[model samples]
Target: MVTSATQVLFPERIYQCEANIQLIAAHPEQGCYVVTDRTPFHPVSHIWPDHPADRGTVVLESQVHEVVDCLVGAVEQESGQLYVGADIPVKRDEPGWVFVVVHHLAESIESSVGTKATLNVDEQYQLALSRGHSGGHLSSLALNKVLHHDFWRKDASRKDELGHYDFHSYAQTESRVTEDCSTDTYRIGKTLRKRGLNAADMIAALPTIADQINQQLAAWCEAGFPVDMRREGEALTDSRYWRCDLQEGVVVEIPCGGTHVTSLAEYAALRVEFQLINEQELVMITHSQPA
Candidate 1:
């Protein structure tokens, strides 16, 4: 096994694990950051930042330190230098660089490297994030279908993972996933206009369109399909995707670099609300919870 950089425990959705601390560093502003040889904590990605960080606790020498945040850290193999979050240079999975999860604490710890450590993930909060992330993906897919049937038929080249008109992919400006909810924002500009998006008519049919999307989500949830993550490798920077088989021969898969629930049963009910701002920006807020 490689020992210089941390290994990410993905495709397992591990909640807690015991690993050795590889490095301990002090940051002037964010307090201290501890790196482990293996971790279950999913850090807030600097590249996307759509889903927030995983907040948990780390035990070092019998002292429990509250991990306020988690972030992606990169190390230079040649220089032995470390860069955290946005400060990191080079794209992820870049050659000659290794990525590690940086657990941020509120204060510094007088610890040394190679110390045995315990990682405890806040299970409830992590579940909430997973729900929101999965719900966001489902909502986007439903929205695409609704728009394709109601507004316009998109060409084959302009389609999403499930072969629906790529409305969300073309117009979405930002997406944020939080506890039991996710918000998606889309900008209706010239590019979207060329793709058959009629801003005025779309704004007028908000209620009807939202109802259609919700109905689709309800049916999918009713099936209680299982979800899984597909990855190319076990490395921290490896390609990962989310896959859900809503029905036989109707599976949906998309590229996602975040966490998700193993089954739709966790989200007994999922719904979305829409709003138009200044006739230019469309906002969608999806709320999900158990029955």
Candidate 2:
């Protein structure tokens, strides 16, 4: 019988583990196999898939199988049956759910249930993602500050760490991080207006708003604030926070599980552009510079 081990490394950091290769089963139709246990590979979260999976190779003996994707797998606590990715029926951390990382192997190998294997990650790609994610967080805070004036009439309902109304939390529909940039989509529908957001006025002055956001981003980048992740514990399920020490005594902290750059100094420049997709939606595109 297979034993489930509690994860040791914090989800925000990359780790290396030597684990047994067990049950590499083909997906019947997806043309891939899922390798179980002991990986440094970070799987794309089923609950929040803002960051993509880490790509690398799984090595055993003299052969190597390229891991094209890494995804979250869950099993029933009582039944011990495994389900991959979106196939999971329950939310993560739900009572009685055991979460695992499913590494997608390119082809079948000769490894057995007890064979030891090594997992290697592409650090270059991981670092690029870290920079993009860090920049993305900062950009969102800047956008919130730039648009704070539009909600002057709302009773102070919620506030971000930077003292702006938490529009990013309520308006955001989807957020994606890429190697060089991050894209965030926000909904400005009836609910937002009901909360006293001037959607029409904001959309009309999008270019000016974008400029203000870019200015804030530039100032933060120039300040070279320290950035890092704070975790409750060194476990996959532990709560993590992305903490940033900005200028003017403003420190922004957001609950986040994704990896990020060590410092804002790594980014020489950051820029953001805005678009009005419809009467009730806005999209922000953010780009970052190299270390």
Candidate 3:
């Protein structure tokens, strides 16, 4: 069983580190699972599972082992049982469970528990995903501002970083990030309408709405806004926030547990497009290029 929460370094921009091997075991279907005292690898969150895991390699006993995948794992306090990814039964931070970052190795290493493992993440791949994640957040905020006044009622309670109605967060159904791109789907069904999103009007003005979001994105990129991931602690289960310093002293903070570039300046340009999948489904796709 895990003695404590794994010390996570990805939240603060760490991508490589030497860590002590806590446990090593072969899974029935997932190959070998390696648990470390600490890691820089960002695992796919079992709860959200939006951003993908960091792909990299682990070096031990002078041998290089490819990390095929990284995933969130938990060890039961009483049973000492380990659960990985989709097999995890309980919610995060559930009582009597210790959370861990599980590194799936293509092959088992010669070293066992108590050995030291040097972890190295694919920097280029990580950077691309960072750009996509940051762009996704900016695009969502811009979309919120563009639709706030037109569709949402004044009584709408939720607001985004720019103080517009936070329609993105409220109606968001699914989100996924890839290399320099992100696609988010939102459902504007009865609940959203009750919250004041005029479905028919929004559909009619889709083109204009897309223009507004793109313009907002252009301005933000030109300003070279700085982005950061603020964490309450270094533990794997600790809370983290994505903060971006925008124009007019506005700071946008959204609860997040994903990696992002240190600055929007990393993006040479950013933009988003809108699509209506059906009468009640809206999809926003964001694309970014690195500077």
Candidate 4:
């Protein structure tokens, strides 16, 4: 039976730690996929796959293993078989499964079970990725606020923290975040138009929209609002939230499963540019400089 889900430490901005090796699974190509009792690695989401995995090295018996990639993984309670990202068939928190962080090491070794191990995440790369995530979120909020006045219809489904039409949540189709950069794609199809996005108007004003979003993002970063994640618990399966205080008395909270830096100031500058790749699709490219 599954007694515990892996405790995730990256949400707390932790970089290094020692933990007991829970399981050591073998892969023909990747070599060893190590699961630890606790880890600072932030695995890419199976559901979204937006933020990239954290990479570094883990020391086992004084031999360092290179962590090529990390993944959200799970083990079947009765079978003891592990499944990596997009391979596991069950939904999260399923009764017979345990969610885990799989540290994909480049080389495989035999007989390391229950061994004490030291995990050290690449701090610089992880911090840069964090800045990209936080900056993307900030850019979305700013875009939502700027578009609220003339973009959506009066009968909007959901609103953001600032009481604005949440175009980011409503229309966003896919998002990908990497080191110091993020790309957000939205579908402005007939359904969205019926729900009241001035698609034609927005297309016509792409440059202006980009300029407004960039200006707003620059201001928000300049204000240096704090960035944080609030977890329901330490378990990898627990619900986590991204929190920020954008303006005085205006705190924004989003249900997010990712890592971030201490504050917006960590991102020296943030900017977003918009593009209309097709008549029915919109894209936003965001970039941030680490401080």
Query: What's the TM-score of each model vs. the native?
Result: 0.95, 0.89, 0.95, 0.95
Q: Best lDDT goes to which candidate?
A: 3
- For each candidate in the order shown, give its overall lDDT on alpha carbons: 0.86, 0.77, 0.87, 0.86
RMSD of each: 1.8, 2.4, 1.6, 1.6
Which is the better candidate, 3 or 4, if ranked by TM-score? 4
lDDT string for model 2 (3-36, tens) is 3523534244565567776445566555455555
Better of 1 and 3 by lDDT: 3
**For residues 25-141, could you state the per-residue lDDT of candidate 1 as single tens digits?**
788686798888898888999988999998889998999999999999997877767799989988876888889898998889987888889999998898898999999999999
Off by over 4 Å in 4: 1-3
Q: How good is model 1 by TM-score?
A: 0.95
Error of 2 at 154 (Å): 2.1
Over 1-291, each residue of candidate 4 has an lDDT whose tens digit, in order, gives: 233479989888889999988898887586789898999999988988999999899998888989999998989978888999989999987988999999898989774678899999999899888888887888888888888897765668788888888888888999999899989999888877888888788788878988998888888778887888888999998999998887736778888888887787887788888877899888998999887
Q: Which 10-residue window of candidate 1 scores lowest in summed lDDT?
A: 1-10
Worst 10 residues of 3 by lDDT: 1-10
12: Cα error in model 4, Å: 1.5
